[model samples]
Target: MLISMNTCSEISVVDCKETAEKLNNAKRYSTIIIVGRIAIEYIGRAVSYAPEGDRIVLLKPDGSLLVHESSKVEPLNWQPPKSISLFSCIENRLKVKSYRTNPHEELLIDFIKVDFIKICNIVTSKLLIMGKESDIVKLIVLNPSSILNASIVVGTDISTPYGKIDILLKDEKENLIIVEVKNEKAGISAILQLKRYLEYYASRGLSVRGVIVAPSLTDEAMAMIIREGIVYIGIDQLINGIKDIYRDIYSYTKFKT
Candidate 1:
């Protein structure tokens, strides 16, 4: 359908069901222009007719016509008329709907144009942090036998001589599973950190099975863990463990699939 704004002398083509479906599926658009018509029922009116097309011609306030298609239209050999208003009435309709639906969203979107980079940076940072944390949790959930064994108890913020341990698992018999997580690299200090956790828990009358988890670990750090008798677990291992738990809990083979 073609919607024209009297104030801005601009026109916009409304999308039809078929066109919207195509866009939804492949999410691709070509520059081809198509024109047709459709019947519409107005809220308070009996019936209405509208142009059903992929292209529309917009009349600028200056009396110049610009051809628009599904993508964009370049003004070809057209001189703009000076008397036309710069703003289009069609945009006012969109603004009205936007404000009615979500004024804050509209305001933020409008302001985003001015602070695009800043807004993008903030959004990206938040998404990255959330994604990292989610990945870490998913990893821990993978091995139910490791996480939920009757003897296992996962503890957070356990104090140690070296630093605060993020998570520590202990069996019912008080055998400790020292876990130290670093979202990024398992640094030089990670091995030592786990050692400290093991020692601290052991001193508290708990035997330890040391485990270190990180996105990646340095060769030196890995060697240190092996030398120090620590088991190293990556995020993917944890995710697998979680999947096993979900399978057991729901009694569904689909999870295993």
Candidate 2:
């Protein structure tokens, strides 16, 4: 005679291990283990067969494989202080050809695409310079909020005692940031125009902070700024400063996480 016992609780450790091993080996399907509860059931994945050339890959936390497709990425290339260089990084993933001859030019191109205004502001602070006037205008349009948020205001074709001011800004402290922007080298006329704006503001009992923005500055123009204690800005420096700010913010958040 034989007796049979049937109970769910009767399974031993050896039996559980054997069952698990069998299940794992049943098929070659990849396994993804979840620790604790999460909002999403599965994370996305991208796998690449080869590591050469341009490609995009989505990945899960674990090493387990998932779906993968091949696609080209763009290459970023440019000269230093160009301000549009940030696009090169994205371009690299797209397999785009780059013709930049030096690292600085390449970096400038990338910086422009990443954040033009910040680059412009930094240029102003550093007094380096920009190669083109259109580049400055493009930077302004790319980040209109920066101009809008300024302590001063800018009006188009505004009548001023010192010719027409391209842009004007007034702060809460009754301080004015007078601006004159040109697409080419700011000549002697640019300086004279700025002086008129300064005198206009001073006549109104407002302290003025003179700013001269041009695609490029002549030696005479730069010397004038130094002698008069006015501020001269270009595009690249602004972009670099913006990048630094972002890097700092990212570092802080990463540390907290």
Candidate 3:
């Protein structure tokens, strides 16, 4: 039977033979964690070794392996995903070795005495992020006048020779506005893109204003935007506006049977 996610079992003070067999048995679909005194040896482009010390060894189903001592956040030794790991017994110690083929690197840990071993069913899910660039565009599209106090949205994703413009708007004064949306800090490249869009419309004899919408701006980008006469809309304001839009959704509660 497949173990449920987040379920873990603890084994105490097992010998090398038993520890090696148990870890190897679950290596395919589980996450194995072993705590013990160990000596580490690594061979790749460089060769290094760690003398006997208490450490934690982690093996993940995705082929990630790591060795950590009681230290900082960074592991003493590690191998990223897709690494092949194998377990075996060497004399009186348990040996855990992990390797990758492309560069042909290897990490060996010799466990002299294990404190405990914990085997867990691995669980993973996709990560979701709000307030993305697309989310910013959606915010503006749903509320045309939310940007630059613009009265209406001309359109979005308007095509150009260089790239597609994010959003086109018209201000209260009847002037066209070119908007380039960025989810994070705006930069010089963003300013340049807006300038290009402004120039594109200008060459066609159109009176257009350029605006950058982002969470923040870099020093260089802020200076450049000032020099080029561009406007900036911070995500703080956009988020406030979004809160109002999502207010009803916020009040919603799931049904309880």
Q: Report lDDT (CA) for all predictions.
A: 0.46, 0.44, 0.84
Question: Which structure among the candidates has the greatest TM-score?
Answer: 3
* Candidate 2 similarity to native, TM-score: 0.41
Q: List TM-scores for all candidates, in order.
A: 0.45, 0.41, 0.51
Candidate ranking (lDDT, best to worst): 3, 1, 2
In angstroms, give how far residue 161 of model 1 lies from its true place: 3.1
Q: Rank the candidates by TM-score, best first.
A: 3, 1, 2
Q: Is candidate 1 or candidate 2 better by lDDT?
A: 1
Q: Mind giving the per-residue lDDT tens digits that candidate 2 earns over 1-257?
A: 33433321111113333423432332132221111111111211321122222212211112221222243242111112212211112322211111233332211111111100100001113553445655554554444323333354555446875577666666667566776778767877788788878888788887888877765688888888888887776545546544565677687877776
**How many clashes in candidate 3?**
0
Candidate 3's C-alpha runs over 4 A off are: 1-6, 131-257
- How does candidate 1 fare on TM-score? 0.45
Top candidate when judged by lDDT against the true structure: 3
Count of steric clashes across candidates, in order: 11, 49, 0
Cα lDDT tens digits, model 1, 135-194, are 564445444364546645465676656777766666777666766777777877878877
Single out the weakest 10-residue window by summed lDDT for candidate 1: 112-121
lDDT of 3 by residue, 13-61 (tens): 4577786788888988889999889999999989999999999999999
Please say which candidate is ahead in lDDT: 1 or 3: 3
